[model samples]
Target: MAAVSPSPPAAASIDRGDSGLQAYARARLAEGDNALGLAVAGYRAALKQDPDRVEIARRSYVQALESGDGALALQSAALLDGAGMLPRDGTLLRIGDALARKDWQAASALTDRMTQEGNFSFLSAIVRSWIAVGQGNYAPPTIDAKDRFASLGQRYLDEHVAYQALNHRDLSAAIPAVRRALVARARDGAALRLTFAAQLAGIGARDEALMLLPADHANFNVARAAILRGRAKEQPFTPAQGYARLLARLAVDISSDPAGRALGLRLARMATFADPLGAEPHIVAARLLVEQDHAGAAVQEAAKVPAKNWFAPLAQAELIDALAASGNLAGALALARQQASVPGAEPERQVRLGRLLAESRDFDGAAAAFRAAQASYEPDKLPWTLLLFEGSALEQGKRWTEAREVLERAARIAPDEPAILNYLGYAQIERRQNVEAALELIKKASALKPDDAAIADSLGWAQFVTGNVAAAVPSLERAALGAPTDATINEHLGDALWTAGRRYEARYAWSAAAINAQGDVAARLAAKSEEGLKPEYAAP
Candidate 1:
């Protein structure tokens, strides 16, 4: 989060100081650092020298947007547009600015330009339709456009149309659009479901809306839909409210794209502005900021959610994570405790607190919190994940007997859970208990998750301890391939190789393991490399 300098700017040739290096530094700031203000300063200096560097301009624009400095984004965008050099996202930036001003004509023109340039293909048509709806010129794009767009694109457009109608209080018009979108997507995306729920509530079918959204789904959309259903009798919906949901949907749709997170963050920020009273956008923005490791920013955004909001608990949970991630572990722990003490906190909130405690190595506290979460579940339906967390925490605290008891219960509840299987199997093998049972559990786990390096190592070690040294060799070799730099896996492979009569490979494996080994592991690996495997390790 700090603004540590990436490198000293080159003193020579200030007029042409490798813009690429400055661009790279800017990128690192966007993708890693929390210091957008400092990044903006550096980007300005670089652009002063290399004014036409489109990439630099683009990064600067996004940094400004993420920092809540729309003025800077618009300024950088204007400069790029004036230079007749638009980056790939330049049009999106300009269009966002235009829509913010309610300048429908300007927004339409920007979309037209993007379409003329063949930049975004069907995206332009979608934007144009939304712009028209924003201006009350509801000339929806023709059905023929559906053929030009794939199912996802067509569904996106349908969602936009439904959103537009809802924004204008035309529930009759929205119903068909929502139906088409849902049918096209086969009822997949959370946002789509949320939209349909809102439409149903708007039509006075509150029961139907409640049925459309599952109560067990722990997300902002579902929470928002439930709120809408509850308020259907008293609250009046507005176009701005509709636009907020639309922006939230767009934000969700783009959040998974590696290159689209920045854009998604910007849209989420817009959603917040669209309806400041709504907590969903703030939650989404906080989540995205946390993913970028901008924990300080995430905390600020999450703290904006009103305490009385139904989704406030979710926001608070994220805020706690942000605090912990930003090195304020004490503050995070205190907040988690407070949330847990609330009269009716959700079970997931307690689970989150337990995970945080576990990550911070307060295993005893983690185990207690996880146990509390488990107690909250109905006697007939305990969540296996809660039991697994409790078991893992107990194991970390060296309470082997308690851990085994809880893990065995978890195994019964969710027999196919890979993590539970792997942890219990590995622990049993380490304790030299139930070798045959551990092998079966680990083998099932490996089949479920064949690519997990840790599970492979466990499977190999189990085979070795059970006197199947020759069989262990292939498993250990596979584990080493997947986790070449894992010291323990390398050591296991070395022992397996030595037992299989591959002395040279065993030494090589031991040496590789020693490279990154530490403490007792380092000492043991070094000795293994120097003196070879012990006599007791030889195969029968």
Candidate 2:
């Protein structure tokens, strides 16, 4: 969820504590990134000083929800709702709670209130259907209700109809709705296909079930695994599984919109409430939590996935990311290593292992892990980004020739990729080979991303090496301005400035560069600042 706007506080709340503390907390929450943890702490401190401040209480609720502290959110939400100021998310939770208790009357009443509020009105049909099913009265939606969803809304409409039809043992009705939902959207068909496959399996239609499976879709892997298990067991989707599927699909759909995280969280939580035994719902909620920088909560959600479920490996992979994000890098690496050794672990886990290794500067180990990941892809269809990563690792390891070979192949496959062009061009310039060719490649890369500081630095260095010091100075200056603290860019700018007779500024730039420079570069920059450029750095 985006950070909440602070409500106007009463005079008593202001006088109760340092107003500055409350203001600081609000500012930090609004600032985004990893500030949620600190914001929560700040809000807690402020709230302790003024427990009756509804504004502060509401802000705490938002921070808690955004941080994926659902239990805390529920508590804070209770306070707000008790004060007759429950937010939209709180309303969703309230409705979900009603549904959980099989209080159809309360659920229907809450849903009506939600509709009146013009929030989550899209959920009215689904919730009503659930209520109907619970009451042993399955009401098929009217034609007008079905017609209201002819376009993109049709997907949700289809889900509602199919779910009700399934509960009523009306497969003929369910099948057409499933097909329309699947056929209408090229993307997001996994959940619909999964539901359809499960229903088919329910009726012993094994061939139809297998036929509905999509090829190589990442989001559908768990569903595929579940379908396979059903095939083996000769069974169908349980009612809880069906409910979980509906909630999962809704969560996925909402998550696609940039402003839908809050709604997505509510639906995911609802899914968990509706089907406590289903691992997929928890995994979905965990992923959304991770996206909002709630790694601790994400880890908690992932931990809820039963170890025996087919989704356990998926949970473990997500836990690896959560651990890393929560600043438990060693734990993440240990888990990654364990995951990698499993006989049939997913290739994505190995890819993750390589990234963690690369971050730790184990370049050789990272390259090996990357190779193992690459082996998972078909040879002819390897992704360009993968090559770029492997090439970068090789370059950082000082395996220059291998790096060049890999980068060149990447450039061929994705000729317009500015990163590949810049890296390959910069590598050529660094080795002092084919200066003119390097200049052309860097120029192409710079044209593609004119404001990129690293590419600008490469462009400047290439010009300086080819005896164009005057021409190089402007580009180098731009690069330094764009990335003021990057040692290499500042050092490059310093060299160009000295060559252009700006000697005093050259020393100033070198001093700044020296702060972050290391090893040979630091020594070289020191010598240049005190005396002048070595013979190597002088104008050609």
Candidate 3:
């Protein structure tokens, strides 16, 4: 009791305790948990103990609001306003939300308060512009808001605003916004300006839009000169360089956007006439043509690439497939044979040739090609799937015993392969001696690739033959969905539909099959459909 020092004062101890509580609350908030409520309670309690801690309470409240708690956000916003710590934008955002909810007086008051502060005049103008647009009063306020954005060096925003102005037919507001964006970021912003200017020209601002070009950017300079000279078509200064640049742009644009890819394909195809030796353009043109369903045209385009290029074999194979698809099997087989005989042809060429030959019904030649191809290449490098082609050719040639042996060996090598399983299963089904075994093989194939139309069709057909017509319908329907344009799947669907007593739908499916089926298969399906119409139509 002599020199006790008064125990350091109770306020100091309370302040230290508050500091510890705030730190714990902040740490929990940082972990992204439900700490906003805890932080709000802690900050409020601390503020009660130390009323001077206004800034600390304001910060905690803001953090709680930003964590997506609308109730907490409103409460914190109120506390910040009470403490005089609310930023202008924060108040504006809250007011904007209130306005969106049709609280007109609150929004108007917030706008007036912000105008008085003079700190967020630009944002206030933008909000006012949006309100004007919403109210259908697109006059002085909209123009003023756009001007404010233009003055702030926000060109992208300005250009977008200009687009909105144009949509409203406010050419006066649009011109200034477009001009401001073009002037502020001329180099990187030329392309967008060119588009806007082209539109402005369409709306009778020819001189103004033309003036935006020739602004030090090369693309713009070229575009402006073209416009002034009345050149409706783009004529590049250096055709090769221009084509190269266009191709580069196309490549980048096509990476994520299909419409861009389609445009790029058209541009590349046009470029190919000028740059005949540039195989890159030809390859892209071929791919685009394929995507466009001009398979024959794609084959012709792909044939221009030299066989020595790395992509030559792939191009040739694609061309052959396309030719086959277009009902030019003879031509496809000839191209395959020519590719096979070419000097330094890769081992994969043999597989391609064999497959084409098999499709053309030259089974002995296909088998010989596959055998020669297998002998010359390493097993790892050889596409083991080619073995299925040899087996299929043998089976079609009525060498069933050998076909079964070869397919069984292929199945062992590629135990999990859906293609091999489907081929073997279908082969068994065709032989009509191992319906149960074929069903097992087809089921395995379907399990591996449930969405593969070819495998699904095989499985459904196998099930149908095994007297499981009800189970087959869903599989056939799924197959039809997966391969809407596939002739075989359509034929299978027709059979399933007929068995399910949907005779009209079955006939429609058969008509679709007749439209899409190719070569012998097409003929066979058509004949079968005709037979089904007869009173004595019988299943093979």
Q: For each candidate, what TM-score against the reference?
A: 0.75, 0.72, 0.46
lDDT of 2 by residue, 175-288 (tens): 787677677645445445655666666666666667777544443455566666674332334334445556677787788886987778767876776667666677788888
The models' CA-based lDDT, in order, is: 0.73, 0.73, 0.61
In model 1, how many backbone clashes occur?
0
Looking at model 3, which ten-residue stretch has the lowest summed lDDT?
1-10
Give every collision pair in model 1. none
Ranking by TM-score: 1, 2, 3
Question: Model 2, residue 71: what's the lDDT?
Answer: 58
Error of 3 at 99 (Å): 52
Worst 10 residues of 2 by lDDT: 7-16
**C-alpha positional error of residue 113 in candidate 1 after TM-score superposition, expressed in Å:** 4.8
lDDT, model 3, position 7: 23
* Every candidate's CA RMSD: 6.1, 7.0, 27.0
Identify the superior model by lDDT, candidate 2 or candidate 3.
2
Q: Any runs in candidate 3 off by more than 4 Å, and if so which?
A: 1-264, 270-276, 287-335, 380-382, 484-487, 494-540
